[model samples]
Target: MKEKIIIIGAGVSGLVAAINLEKAGFNSVILDQSDRVGGRVKTDYREGYQFDHGFQVLLTQYPAAKKYLNYNLLDLVEFDPGSCIFYHQKKYYIGDPSRKLSLLFPTLLAKIGNVADKLKILKLSKALKKKSFDDIFLAPETTTLVYLKEKGFSDEVIKKFFKPFFTGIFLESELTTSSRKFEFVYKMFAEGSAAIPKKGIQAIPNQLAAQLKNTELEFNTSVEHIKANELVLTNGKTLAFDYCIIAAEAWPIIANLKNQESAWKSVENLYFKVKEKVIKKPLIGLIADEAALVNNIHYQPIKKSDNYLLSVSVIKQHNLSKDELINRVEEDLAIYCDIKVDSFVKYFKIKKALPVMHTVNYMMPPSETQLKDRIFLAGDQLSNGSLNAAMLNGESAARAVIAKIKNGFINVN
Candidate 1:
């Protein structure tokens, strides 16, 4: 008989785990507390607009994503290669001239950084391109801020460009995330486009979930406690399993698990419907002001519709009320776009947007994935905070389980 595996959390990790297990001739059951899939990567449609749970983009070059996902089916809409930096009461356009030749003159003239700084960007990209994924993550670790300074990036560029840009990505104002993560993300951006599915970000997970033929997904089913070879549900029911995988954030469920990081980064995304396009191009806008409450903005045009959907992200949580926050965001948008924005639609304050990891790895070893005799753990927290990491760890855990089953190391009862 095939081993009865129970995987917790129907997020990308859990879904991928089940997919891989099924390929290896073992079927698994997935349990999730939420009503749907895509734990943090969900999307909501409101009044003819699609708003992702948070401002998110899928880097098309993610190795694991490329391996598993069918991008053509996603109907992705790509963002322009660079950013429109709002600095000192002016908008400066900067882009990778290598990718788009038209951006060459604009990037050179943009005052966000010096000519040498721009050249250094190309050099950095070239250097990172030669470094393999293993090399990037295994290199000595340090804060991204320190790494940039060591690379001789000027303060002007770091402040007006890298700081605001990566702050939005990392969800941390300070560039204190590991340099390894920065390199990995930078490599991804340099290699491919940052895009979202025409439907929404949730489509990525929906695609993965749809591929499961043998796995059973049980939603709104919470696992209250994980025990030895069994699970206790919140409704006072228990079920036995030959193997269990904690594909969710393990720190919360497994009490004895060590080295699990629970600290999470937060972000607030405020959406608005505008009559005119706030940004002509599909490029991310960064607020370079040190004290600006609005960290970044993107205006996504709704297909076959007259109105455009504007998404403004604030990396920090403030004491301001919803009205106050909206007012401040409107003020910022007015200055950035030179047009008034008052059509406030919704605000998404996500407290656990991304896991905070000081140290990161490309993948975890099989031996490390096994928490106990018959239990395992998998998530982005096990490696780095990215969709790529989540999928990588999930497959890693699934392979570990497959190896054990093939070796007959663990008895199936």
Candidate 2:
């Protein structure tokens, strides 16, 4: 008999698990608490417009993601060396000072004391690529900020570039994370392009889901529990399976698990559509100002025929109303892009932006858990948090189930 697998959460992780398990000759079904797949990689469309609340950027080099992405079909667009500008203490700079030619704009943006400071920045940026996450973390002498200060990065550069960039990426102002995560993210931007599927970030998951037409999908259905070899849904339905994969974010599904609960991390994101384009570079701008906030401005110029999309991220802050948040971001955008608030046409806010995967603070353990024999956990959080990490983890979990089925109900891949 074919081994049956029940995968929870139709997000990227779950979808990946289904595809791989089916390929290994196991039957699988996907279930998501939401009505659709692609958790953060979502695209909203209806009234002659398409928008993504959790506007995502895909890193082409992310290994597991690379395995499934079809550039021809998904319409991948590159944001290479996309004109980067920074807003620090209300003042802005046009480019990164680490480059030699960039120094010509020094007086405008580089608040460093002298040429030596700029040289230090150039040297550090070059050397950062060679260093691994372990080299920084295992060092007895430094925290992230301390390491930068020791490396001669001034308070000005830290506040201007690193802070804002990190905030937008991690959604937290403080660099209170494992150096590995920082290095992982920094390396992606440093080594490659930040891209989005021309169709939308949802294309990746949509493609994966399409591959599993033989696999049953229960959308808008929440799982109530998982037992020896079955899952119970909130709708009072029970599904029997040879194995189960819980790929949903740990917060909602993990706590009520039949076996165990996993920790979770949350991120907040906001999106706005404007009447006029604010920044020429479609993907540009960063904000790390005295207001104690940071976000990225994604001006959708390619979709110029439509509205300009400005997606902002605020990691730790909560409790602000939609209008107030949009107004503040509008003010920041105006200052960063030298545009006015009247340009905006519509706005939408989506909170809990991305999974914050660190060694602690809601970090999930691994793909295979203590109950590895029957139930498995998969997601970016467990995959150690990245499109690649999440997909890799899902593949790992699927391989495990496939191995069990192949080895007369034992474990492998």
Whose lDDT is greatest here? 1
Model 2 agreement with the true structure over 347-385: per-residue lDDT tens digits: 545545555444521123332532457777777776355
lDDT of each: 0.87, 0.64
TM-scores of all predicted structures: 0.96, 0.83
RMSD value for candidate 2 = 4.1
What CA RMSD would you report for each candidate?
2.4, 4.1
Can you tell me which runs of candidate 2 are displaced by over 4 Å?
Answer: 46-48, 88-143, 250-268, 292-294, 303-307, 316-319, 343-349, 360-370, 408-413
Quote the lDDT for 174 in model 1.
85
**Ten residues in a row with the worst lDDT in model 2?**
360-369
